[model samples]
Target: MSLTLYALGVAVLLSASFFYLFGYRSWRRRRVMAKPFPADWQTILDRDVWVYRHLPEPLQARLRPLIQVFLDEKRFYGCAGLTVTDTMRVTIAAEACLLILNLPLSFYDDLRAILVYPSAYRVPDIHREGEVLSESSGVHLGDSWQRGKVILSWEDVVAGAGHHQHGHNVAIHEFTHQLDQADGSADGAPMLRSSNALRTWSQVFSKAFDNLQKTLEQGHSELIDPYGATNPAEFFAVVTETFFERPRALHREHPALYRQLQQFFDLDPLSWTRAGD
Candidate 1:
């Protein structure tokens, strides 16, 4: 064989060896990202996700990479004859990825599967009444489980994205719960797990929670969703919805709370909004 041919053969062997040493998943991730993003996916994003279109160029660049990795790694299943399509997956994945766009974390490391429902799905509603437990069922648009699962309703997901100013995204709400669960518990604060800026976060969130409860008791609830008063965990999730969907409103109504979320996510969503909106 010619010397050039022998060198080429040796290079191929070395490349294969490197790929094996690094891990197949990482190798495949590089390969997956090397390709151009599908134009059809961009069209779906434009139509389905209002936030995606408004994101600043830099953040937009950061997001596509995360979306690609999320779609590649996370598993999705259809429930109730949902027939989860690329549009659904892309819409949900885009919203979820937005939360983690600039933050440091695995792409939803603990999340292994997403169960998509055609609409609101029924779940067992267990309530405790001061030493009494009542068993009932309720319908939810989406939920995140600490044990590697997330469930979402396709219709609600679209609705949530459609009403971007409402700050009521099912995908964003449930995914925020997953972020809260990162510290091994859902106490409405994920800063204990992923952020060093804890003092301000604790001070602001605690005060805000107290203020919300007091205000609600006084029969005045605006500026934020009253459902956030449920608990710290739900509060965390709910505020996240507001933070992304209604950033300007949240910033105007509760600047301190918005700063805390901004600190944690390491991204200022206000930049994604319009000049005056």
Candidate 2:
């Protein structure tokens, strides 16, 4: 054989070895993560997360693996002198995974880290003045970035988890933003299963948003929080919070909008309501 041919064969062997090792390591890591769900974590979810308790037992079983994989894939950091705990991790993961419980799990794959603050934290707001940008800071309960980071106030997370029917869950709200960002733009639209689905969603959401705006202007009480009327992206996130947190109210007040969310999420939270009763 020619020297060049021998060298080529050796290179192919090395490449195969490298790939095999990498794949093996990944399989081993996932095997470890697949271990039975921890009892302490179950205790945390039971004690802290009201929504989890409302879920049917089979759905709870399905959600457990999603939570485990979520905890395995994402990293958490404590900011503002807060010490992160297992309870915090499990609580956050459970709430966040609740959004994608019925959808494919790939939606959150781009998300890499979650930064938790002890309370509402200040983030600088940048205003572009043509030639320069001005900065001012304001306190925020939570924020999601397109670059794979989510910031949350630990206090608000705890409150939101406990108060399941208040139409306010920071974890669910921010994670929905992550879902919106999955398609490379936070434009209140995630990648739907089909173009037809997108059209239906667009028509329903646009009409709902307009009606919501009109209702807010008329100073009438709305089932969805007024904060959702801010923008399409915020509207999606805000309504997502209400969908999971207060499903019955959403279904009753905005049946069309609630159906759109149900189709997109592929889960009927209203059934959970009936189950709870």
Candidate 3:
């Protein structure tokens, strides 16, 4: 062969090999991500994921793959001498996935790990206002951090999952905070699509939050948790719990706020029958 022909043949061979290797790696990565759903995890989901069982068949079908992805990606740590089991992981993943089921989600990209306790956990109740700091002991069911960690009590998780009628789910509450903190702050708002959407969100959220505070100040019971009046961040989390757990009440009491949440979440819980249905 001529020297030029030999050189060109070598170049073509190298190019073909490079493309083949790249394609193989891409296929391999996809296969790894598309791992088969585990039978034990499915059993756990069937038994412990109460909210999931209540979802419509279509929604459940849609959510199962996402739950699989979430389980595959995130890490779970047992705290307070608790041993994290497939049940714990599935239960937590199911509730957390419910929030993002109808929305575009990267599977809570900011969160790296979930820390669970066997029961209520204690933390330093440190209050920092400017330069002043006061420390005390406080008990919590669950808490989420901006630095990619969520702490939960497994007892609370089970209770919240099993009792959707109570409008209290520690898993839902804390994970909502994770979504709120996705944009670097747990300031009540999550990542929205546009400036206009943000403005609408601010107006609707601020008005409802103020009304909740007013109702609390008047010493009358409110439909949503009064703890929501704590701050905009907590208000968002607290109302989220109510929105999913007690959608009918939220809609009847705070129609505008419920509509806003419905728009943001892209789901209508009221349309579907509850667990018994």
Q: Which candidate is the best by lDDT?
A: 2
The C-alpha RMSD of each candidate to the native structure, in angstroms, is 6.9, 3.2, 5.9
Write one digit per residue (lDDT tens) for candidate 3, span 127-160: 9999999999999999998888999999999999
Per-residue C-alpha lDDT of model 2 across residues 163-227, encoded as one tens digit per residue: 68878999999999999999999999999999999999999998998999999999998988899
lDDT of each: 0.85, 0.90, 0.86
Candidate 3 collision pairs: none
TM-score of each: 0.87, 0.89, 0.86
Worst ten in a row by lDDT for model 2: 24-33
Misplaced by over 4 Å in model 2 are: 1-33, 129-132, 274-277
Q: Cα miss at 167, model 2 (Å)?
A: 0.8
Worst 10 residues of 1 by lDDT: 191-200
**Model 3: lowest-lDDT 10 consecutive positions:** 24-33
